[model samples]
Every structure is written in structure tokens, then in C-alpha cells.
Target: KLLSVGALTLDTILRVETLPVHQGKFIASDGLQIASGMATSAACAAHRLGAEVSLWASAGDDAVADQL
Candidate 1:
């Protein structure tokens, strides 16, 4: 068994057409949101190795926490 400990974060990634030279409102052509952390990665690896894995991260009560 493995106990993984680390942070859980909500990450946002945005893709734009071009770099901006000045301050202006821009549109994102694409975007992605992912919940990831070091502990999660380790837990996955352990599971792949046939080890029982557990995540011991704190996810406060909230909508985003549910996603995590």
C-alpha cells in the first residue's frame, strides 16, 4: 500500500493565436482545465505498479474540491 501526500490544484490552460505587444482584450482559441498534483501522479504510478494506493490530500468542501 502507498499513501500519497501533496497538493491538489485546479489548473487552467489557454491558447491564443498570437502574442500581444500591448494591453488589449484577447480571445482564446482553445482552453483546458485539469486537476492535478504530485500526489495524484504518484498514486497513479503506484496503482499501475499493482500497489494499493491512497490519496491523502485535503479537498475543502466546494464545487472545485469535488472536481479534485
Candidate 2:
């Protein structure tokens, strides 16, 4: 089994045709939101590779943590 210990963070990804050069309103064609961080990501990868994985991430007791 793999034990991953680190921070677990919530991430947001947006798909856009192009990056804006100037500050302006923008719209996303698609997007994904997920919980990811160095160790958490590693744990996920290990699990996908058929290994038993566990994650030990530090998180605050709040909405963000609940989402994780």
C-alpha cells in the first residue's frame, strides 16, 4: 500500500479558446473542478496502477475541506 501525506487542495480548471492578454470578461467552454494536490494526486495515480493507496492530507474544517 502507498501512503501519501501532504496537502489536499481544491482545483478549478477552465477550457478557453485563448488566454486573454488584457483584463476583461471571459467565458469558459468547459471546465472541471476537483480535489488535487501533490500527495493526493500521487495517491490517485498509485490507486489507478492497482496499488492500495491512502492519503493523509492536512485540511481545515470548513466548506473547502468538506468538498474534499
Candidate 3:
């Protein structure tokens, strides 16, 4: 059996976007977000190896908790 804990860091990927400079604003050409966590990854890997897994994480107010 495997156990996991902690919240996954939700990422906001930006493509073809530049950092703001001198109050200049930049736009992202594309963006991709993923719901991933340390525990989740571990559990998934364990599951693939034919093992039972469990996760115990502290989630935020967003639906990320339920999603996990």
C-alpha cells in the first residue's frame, strides 16, 4: 500500500509570453494547466505497479480538493 499527502501545485503555463517590464503588459500565446500532486503521482505509480494507494492532503477552498 502507498500513501500520499500534500496539495498539488497547480501550474499556469504561458507560451510566447514575456515578463512585464516598466509596467508593460505581455500576453500569453497559449496556456495549459494541470492538476498534479506529489501524492497523486506516487499513488498513480503505485497503482500501475499493482499496489493499493491512499492520499491525505490539505486542500484549498477551490475544487482542487475534490478533484484530487
Error of 3 at 10 (Å): 1.5
Cα lDDT listed for each candidate: 0.86, 0.92, 0.71
lDDT computed for candidate 1: 0.86
Query: Model 3, residue 30: what's the lDDT?
Result: 91
Residue 22 displacement (Å), model 2: 1.7
Across 1-68, the per-residue lDDT of candidate 1 in tens digits comes to 88999877778889999988999999999999887778887888889989998888887899989887
**Candidate 3 Cα lDDT to native:** 0.71
Q: Which sections of candidate 3 miss by over 4 Å?
A: 17-24, 48-50, 63-68
> Taking the tens digit of each residue's C-alpha lDDT, what string does model 2 give over 1-68?
88999989999999999999999999999999898999999999999999998899887899988888
User: Which window of ten consecutive residues has the lowest lDDT sum in model 1?
Assistant: 35-44
Best by TM-score: 2
Q: lDDT at 35 for candidate 2? A: 89
What is the TM-score (0 to 1) of candidate 3? 0.55
- For model 1, the stretches where C-alpha displacement exceeds 4 angstroms are 45-51
Q: How far is candidate 1 from the true structure (C-alpha RMSD, Å)?
A: 2.3
